[model samples]
Target: MSKKVAVLVAGSWGTALASVLAANELDVVMWTRSEEQATEINTQHTNTRYLPGAELSPRIRATSDMEAAVADAAAVLIVAPSSAMRAVTHQFKPFYTPDMLIIHATKGFETESLKRMSTVISEELECEEGQIVVLSGPSHAEEVVKRCPTTVVVASLDKTSAEAVQGLFMNAYFRVYTNRDMLGVELAGAFKNIIALGAGMSDGLQFGDNAKAALLTRGLAEITRIGVEMGANPLTFSGLAGIGDLVVTATSQHSRNWRAGSMLGQGQKLDDVLQSMGMVVEGIRTTQAAYFISQKYGVQMPIADQLYHVLFQNRQPRDAVEALMGRDPKTEMEVMKLETWEQWHS
Candidate 1:
């Protein structure tokens, strides 16, 4: 018999994972905060609001009761937004154990605490390092649910923990790679959202691909700078969790980050943009967290700073883009190498 796996959060990603697990012929329970969503998944076998046309597996069930969903599961995947991770973890912690693998699909640090999703999970679940794992990459929930080819990374200090999840999710169309650089993978996942927002804003402004390319590249530099200072491996930024994820999120129409930024670029207010998107644009809040983290570490994240201004300080997106273009050019690789050296020391 296949082991039970519970996926918290019945959002697109969570539902997609549950669909995958059920397709794998594993018993899957999806925990939804909403009774209506739970009923849809349990009775209709479709998440009508989020994933419109996809037919979910009959083996997949949904529930409003967290305990019922998580109780029999050998592994628990938490897919809540970063903003809600702490409170959600607090609620689940009492039932957690070191024997079960805890996987976090949420990315980004807390704006106030600057704690990574893994850190928050560790504290809440009181799990050892080996028990915590992070799953991330360019894979969108919508595409994955459709069984499209997608690749992602499972990052953990423990190779066993990483491989365990890699085994769980690897199938015909989905490939999972393992990486020891948990910090890098996690940081890359969080920081890419900020850059994706910039990419969307650029696209919204009708800036050419040249401008979009520059934003994507420079945004990577800033992410690497802060990540290295925080002890993440520099090479991880060149991997799937970094560049690959950035490309997909920044460019895809399905990305809430891109949509939010596009609306902002078109002169819509932040609150209005968020309301229209209906889902949490993690990058907006994550940009605030990344900005504060950079300041605390004394790392110069120019793109993040510019994004912060655009999002909160009322700076125009075009003005920010122009400011970036007008900056004096220096040897770009020099900064990249410096960030690498900082990681070695950190």
Candidate 2:
């Protein structure tokens, strides 16, 4: 019998992954709250609203019934948005077993609690936090659906679980790498969206490549700073989940965070931009969380600070740019001299 994999909440990324599993000869079942979406996937084999112009494999199926979706499934992937992570995991409480491999591909922190997706999953599912695998990197749903070459990193303290997920998702077009620094991987994945949004605003303002180059470099430093303060390996910030994800997100047209920021730069109101996006711009929520996190950690995240003001304080994007350029001069290695850096190494 073929192994069954259950995917929660069939969004663009989830559906794209479902296609990958189906192509690999696994029986894929997607659970959606909307019966209409479930019917569309089961009968039409396409989620036109999310991933248009692509056909799904016959091995893929959809169900609105949560229990049925997970029944006998070897693995259950939780791809719910950060805001929905808790409620969605609670839905799994009735069905989850100790042996079911749990994986999450969601990026961004829980806005209210500022918790990583893995932490929230473990909390709701009553499992050890180390057991949940986090799948992240530069892969975008739009490109992955077209069979584009993509690579991602999966991290877990449980080495065997990470290897199992890597085996489950790796294929000719999709490659998976394993990283032991799960904290860094999750931190990088969540933090990059903020930089990507900043990058989009820069481009939208027509600030050119020089500004973007500087933003990305400094943005990475702060991400690493906060990650290190939170007990992550600094080297992980240089890996695929860090630099690789940041570059792709900040530069790609496929990034919703970037798109939202671009619209903001182009003079659109937040409500208007979000309405037009028809999707959750995770970075918008993430920025608020980042603001609180930086304060708590005593980490100086200048770019994130500026973005938080521009996003929530209604400070003009142009003013944010000016503030950044006008900052007092400091050595480039100042990032290495933080108290957290010294303490972390000590």
Candidate 3:
């Protein structure tokens, strides 16, 4: 029997991953809320709204029924937007079985609970948190569907589960790596979008490579600082889910967060920019969550703080940039203190 995988929510990333599994000759079933979308994927094999101009594999099928998608599946990969993750997982709970491997490709936290996607899924499923694996990295759905060479990481507290997910998604065009730093992987992946938004704002404001480069650099520091304080392995931030994801999201036109930030930088109002995008820009909400997270942890995230003011408080984008540049003199490695480095190495 061919391996079967269920992808929840037929969004761009979900569809792209379904295609990869289909390529591996797995029986792939995708669940969507929209009957129209399910019909399109089932009949036309195309997801025009999320992944326009891309032909999905015929081996991939779509359905609107939750039981139909998850029934007897070898693995269930939840790719719902973070905002919808809890509800979606709750819907799948009735059908979820302990024997089925659970993985999530969703990034970002529950705005209400400030919990990671894996944590949210675990809570809903009533399972050990370690059982849920996170698939993340620099691979954008746009590039992945095109079979552009992409590398990603799947991480879990359970090594066997992580490796299982890695094997299921690995292919010639798409490479997968395994990591045990589940917390760091999730944290880095979510936190990097905040930086990417800042990067886009920098570009939109006509700041050159120097400014953008500095943002990416210090942005990593800010996220790493918080991640470390939150019990994440600092080295994981240097890995794919960390720096790798951060670089692509911050620089690529494919990044919705970056594009949204660019518009904000160009003086567009938050409501206006979101209206133009027509897609969920994770960074906007994430910036809000990160604001409270930084305060709760007592971590100084200068870039995220500036973004919060710019996006929410009507602080001008240029002023945010100026504030970042005009901060009091400090050592470059303040966030990555010597003790933290030693702790990581030890």
Q: What is the C-alpha lDDT of each candidate?
A: 0.87, 0.92, 0.93
For 1-346, candidate 2 gives per-residue lDDT tens digits of 3399999989999999998888788999999999999999999999998999989888999999999999999999999999999999999889999889999999889999999999999999999988899999998999998899999999999999999999999999999999988999999999999999999999889889999999999999989888888888887889999999999999988999989989998888899999999988889888999999999989899999999999899999999999989999988886654665666568
List model 1 lDDT by residue over 123-194, tens digit each: 888777557899999988899999999999999999988998898988998899999999999999999999
Q: Number of clashes in model 1?
A: 0
Ranking, TM-score, top scorer first: 3, 2, 1
Task: Identify the runs in model 1 with alpha carbons over 4 angstroms from their true place.
Answer: 337-346
In model 1, pairs of residues that clash are none
**Best candidate, TM-score:** 3
Ranking by lDDT: 3, 2, 1
Tens-digit lDDT track of model 3 for 82-163: 9999999999999999999999998799988889899899999999999999999998899899999999999999999999
TM-score of 2: 0.97
lDDT score, residue 158, model 3?
97
Q: State which candidate has the highest lDDT.
A: 3
